[model samples]
Target: MNTSHQSFAYTLHDVTCLFRKHFDRRAIRYALTRAQWRALKAIRRREGMSQTELAEFLEMEAIAVGRVIDRLAAAGFVERRADPNDRRCWRLHLTSRAHAVTDDMEVLASELRREALAGVSTADFEAFERVLGKIRSNLSAIESGTEAGAEFTSS
Candidate 1:
């Protein structure tokens, strides 16, 4: 019954899929799976994080993230060492090679963003981002069983 909601859903899904395809095209050259790349980015952002912490940040299972870290270590893109304070935990660190790849991934993401916003005006984009942020906050509140948002809904 609501054409506007349908349109919003379609555009959001389409844009997300398109962005993934674009990023994959650019990222394939680095020979890293998307999971590996994401793990690398997270590790780079929070160097020396234990694998369990990284999994929580990534919202992935610890075992799955452990496998990714294993591959990354085997490829020499990352090194995992026993935590000084916690022997059972393996702290992750990106090698120089992984650092370079993550840096390039940022450049690629910037280029993709530039292309996606080629004709959008700054004001319009800022408004769009503000709306998205508001929606995100609203959903976060809902998830936490707090007050549901009524202000943004149609009358």
Candidate 2:
């Protein structure tokens, strides 16, 4: 692989780490941890999803997500309702309180994104997004065994 290709992976990792660091610094003012913010955002995306589904979506352990839900519930930000289709499962829902909080969080996130992309032109930003989407799709295909590179073996 060329040097530029090798640098691409490092650049992506560094960008992600730096973004998280900045977000974490800003998140303290909202009295929420990065994990809590992540959980909240995932829940907001799929309001009626079960804990198992959430754990999968967040790529976290179910127990860890349960703990996050517990904290959110204690803070009046989330609620769990019995699943009508499955007695053993609970459907998670955001409270009215969480809705208001989510709105404020959205504004904060927008500000951070704007600051991060200050010098980028709209065309460049759109192209970057498309490239990211393609990368994700390619990776997903490999993981699902649909792509030829799925058979990864440890040396």
Candidate 3:
């Protein structure tokens, strides 16, 4: 690649690295990995979500989701109950400890987000969100093979 292209790639990698570093440092006090925290928040939004549903919502693989659940369960941050209507499925629920951690996590995340967007105005933020949404949609369409006239497909 050209020098400019290589520089852009390194910049992107640095941004990703910094984001993960900050998130891990802040989230460690809650005794959760980033994935575990995301799963917990999703469960809090809609309790009793099946593993498959959680995986779909997070755009993650079922096995990866299961690993997060396992860690959270072992730490007493979540409970996995057998789905009443489907014996084959398990429903996820946040424990009391998880709820307590969520409040602090919310504050920490908000502060971090504020710092990240320190100079951005509300309008700018909204525009950024819209652009991000479009990018996400475009990537999803490509991944699903639904872009242009292609039929829907999944990897």
Candidate 4:
């Protein structure tokens, strides 16, 4: 194995950490914690998702996501509507205020993305994305035990 290839996982982790750190710093002005902003973005993507569904999508505990939703609701960024089909469940919706804030967030995120991709050629970026997508698919398969490392072999 190439020694440089061994560092791929570390490099990926470092890049993700740095991106989140930079976003956290830049997002501070919005007066929302990272979790709050993340939840808001997730909710925006799929409006009227149940809290349980949101928790699963966010990969967060139900209780923790509940608190994030609570804070967002208090801030007038979200509203909970009773689910008619499931009387005990609440369907989440973004308020008009949240739509405005998320629009601003989208602009801020675009600026950050542009800054991160600076000097990268479009073809190179596209290739990078393709590779990452493959990696994600492989990992998901492994996690589900559908692949079970069946392709592994001695070099």
lDDT of 3 by residue, 1-155 (tens): 34454474477579778877887798886666778888988999999999999999999999999999999999999999998998999999899998988888888878888887889899988976765566578778779898633332323
Off by over 4 Å in 2: 148-155
lDDT of each: 0.90, 0.85, 0.83, 0.89
Clashes of each: 0, 0, 0, 0
Q: Pick the candidate with the highest TM-score.
A: 1
- Candidate 2 worst ten-residue window by lDDT: 146-155
TM-scores of the models, in the order given: 0.93, 0.87, 0.76, 0.92
Instruction: Return the candidate ranking by lDDT, descending.
Output: 1, 4, 2, 3
Q: Pick the candidate with the highest lDDT.
A: 1
Clashes of 4: 0
lDDT of 2: 0.85
Model 1: lDDT of residue 155? 46
Model 1 C-alpha lDDT versus the unseen true structure:
0.90
Per-residue lDDT of 98 in model 1: 84
On a 0 to 100 scale, what is the lDDT of residue 70 in model 3?
Answer: 92
Ranked by TM-score from best down, the candidates are 1, 4, 2, 3
The residue pairs in collision within model 1 are: none
Deviation in Å, model 4, residue 125 alpha carbon: 0.8
Question: In model 3, how large is the Cα lDDT of residue 10?
Answer: 74
Lowest lDDT block of 10, candidate 3:
146-155
